[model samples]
Target chain A: DVKVTQSSRYLVKRTGEKVFLECVQDMDHENMFWYRQDPGLGLRLIYFSYDVKMKEKGDIPEGYSVSREKKERFSLILESASTNQTSMYLCASSFYGETYEQYFGPGTRLTVT
Target chain B: ELKVEQNPLFLSMQEGKNYTIYCNYSTTSDRLYWYRQDPGKSLESLFVLLSNGAVKQEGRLMASLDTKARLSTLHITAAVHDLSATYFCAVSVAGNQFYFGTGTSLTVIP
Candidate 1:
């Protein structure tokens, strides 16, 4: 079984504070993704990394960035958290090719006040 | 812009009934996936349809894809309360990237 774990299951931060959400996968997958899920809007991609030090912006990347310094870990960074940034953050990983089914971690519900 | 859309955003049905959730994508892609997410939990991969006319089933849930139509269907047979969850369909694009639908929240009333 593949295991994807997040650093935090819940978090709270004040406005303009820096926040980091971390994800680690044991499957050694090459592709990692960050997504924010909101009610009615579903899961929107924020950023993705294909390889170490390689990152790409997804549809909703504003105010957020990602780091992939190692193959097993991916981190999502909020430059300065705002109330609007409060969301359930999900991290997923998949193999580079063939099957692209993503394995998701337990999400982090971030609250910004 | 690439888009993946699912219909009947909210569904309520009685146990033992049948229903299907539809997923439509805006681009041409042969690989589609189905996932189930329980409340307050991560998503669990359900099915992967790799080509047109591909179908996969597990227990009460079945998923099929039609590449030409850019659509996928998740059919629930004899719906059970345990089957209630938010279902999402995703289409693979540019090889590694995926566009996910808004999801269909299903509730099976006992």
Candidate 2:
């Protein structure tokens, strides 16, 4: 089974503070993604990395950035956290080819106050 | 750009009842996925429909994809309380990125 682990399950930060959410996958997948799940809006992609040091902006990449220094780890960074940034963040990873199924992390519920 | 939409944003059904959630997407796609998510939790993979008329079943849930129509359906038979969760359908156009539907929130009441 594939396992995706997030650094924090819950986090609280004040406004204008920088926040980091970490995700690691044991399967050594080549694709990693960051998404924010919201009510009614569903899961919106924030950023995705296809390979180490390669990143692409998704539909909702504003106010957020990502890092993929290694194949197993992907990081989401909030340059300046705001109250609007509070949401459940999810990390996912998939293999290099064939299947597009992404294994997701447990998710981190971030609260920006 | 690929867009995925789900109908009947909210559904409430009794145990042993049957219902289907609809997912429609724009443009062509070779891969469609179904996922279940509990409140404040991550998504759980349910089905991966890869081709037209592709169908996959697990437990009381069955997912079917019609690539020609750009639609997918998730049917629930004799749903139980444990099946109460938000179901989402996602479409992968380029086999790289997935666009998720708005999601269908289902509640199974006894």
Please give the CA lDDT of all the candidate structures: 0.94, 0.94
Per-chain TM-score, chain A, candidate 2? 0.98
**Which regions in candidate 2 have their CA more than 4 angstroms from the true location?**
none
What is the per-residue lDDT of model 1 for residues B26-102, given as tens digits with 9 covering 90 to 100?
A: 99998999999999999999998888999999999999999998889999999999998999999998778888999
Q: Which docking category, incorrect, acceptable, medium or high, applies to candidate 2? A: high
Cα error, candidate 2, residue B77 (Å): 0.8
lDDT of model 2 at residue B86?
95
Clashes of each: 0, 0
Cα misplacement distance, residue A26 of candidate 1 (Å): 0.9
Docking class of 1: high
Per-residue lDDT over B1-67 for candidate 2, one digit per residue giving the tens place of the 0 to 100 score: 6789998899999999999999999988979999999987889999999889999999999999998
Query: What DockQ does every candidate get?
Result: 0.85, 0.84
